[model samples]
Target: MADEVSDAGTVRADAWIWSVRLTKTRSQAASACRAGHVRVNGERVKPAHAVKAGDEIRVFHAGRERVVVVSKIVRKRVGPPVAATCFVDNTPPPPPREFVAPVAVRDRGTGRPTKRDRREMERLQGLGGDGPTAR
Candidate 1:
């Protein structure tokens, strides 16, 4: 069942993605392929595209891109440990949260931001205008 590899030496791109736990569901994997968010060997592929071992897959989902090289092919969804062995993850680490711009938060019941407050919030977000008013 979960441990068995495909005897055909290849599987559908969408099925392989889900079986390897790259996406949450098989349907989501298919949708991603249809939306052109999945690529195989550097080319966009359909959901039914054949995926074999040693192929590189690039998927963009959940606001992040994942790049992995297929190490083993599985047709049925497997556990995390088994799924982990199916691919060689090549995705880079995400940027640190500290480097992200902080959102401006106002206390509950606070009225609309005053012009000065709006300007300050814009400055903090690096969206301030370059005109003299920005200084």
Candidate 2:
């Protein structure tokens, strides 16, 4: 409803993020802000920071960074469709899975990796041949 939108023209950073579904919960948004994972206009912001329309916000969450421009101000959590209208997402697309290098996973109960295993893993990770003794 129209009443759900903030008439004050600004809302708390965490509340806006949560209302727009940028984060799963308001607490998560607040935690991210407290941890220096949220920014407004390129400066780190606290959870209580006031966010107005047109402000640029960057949030690091769930292993990815999200960049969005505030488009509308909503004080209460809204549906996904409504939330989508609240911000203009400018995040870059994620890299393709094929572009990601495979991580070396050692089996459990293997204790520690042997020297050769370490070397091999390093080689697979493209970190080989350039060590203190390589010369």
Candidate 3:
């Protein structure tokens, strides 16, 4: 909105990130900046850093990284539809999740495993050397 613009035609980094919907809250954006997770033009930035149209911003958050080029600047949070026009997303698709093997579980009443059982379980988990050698 016109009220969200500054005379310099730029907005604070955290505010812009929130306004564009890159983050759920401006505080989170600030924390990310403080943690060195927000970059502008490939250089780390602070929460108060000024961001203008055409700057490339990279944010690492929620276990994923987002790469976006600023298309517009707004200081007030906008709806998703309007927010989408505020940046050009260049983030790659998330990596596929690998299948994790199920962990071994004993019965509820089972007692502590014996040394042999421990060794066998360790072998199954690939944590120890090969199994018992031939006699």
Best-performing candidate as measured by TM-score: 1
**Residue pairs of candidate 2 with colliding backbone atoms:** none
What are the Cα lDDT values of the candidates?
A: 0.90, 0.92, 0.85
- Report the Cα RMSD per candidate: 2.2, 2.7, 4.0
The segments of candidate 3 whose C-alpha lies over 4 angstroms from its true place after superposition are 5-8, 99-135
- The best-first sequence of candidates by lDDT reads 2, 1, 3
Best by lDDT: 2
Ranking by TM-score: 1, 2, 3
Worst-scoring 10-residue span by lDDT in model 2: 1-10
Better of 2 and 3 by lDDT: 2
- lDDT by residue (1-135, candidate 3, tens digit) is 677643348888999998888889889999999999999999999999999989999999998899999887787888898888778999998766655554667778789997777766776677864647511
Per-residue lDDT of candidate 1, residues 90-113 (tens digit)? 999999999887998889888999
Off by over 4 Å in 2: 6-8, 110-115, 129-135
TM-score of each candidate?
Answer: 0.88, 0.86, 0.74
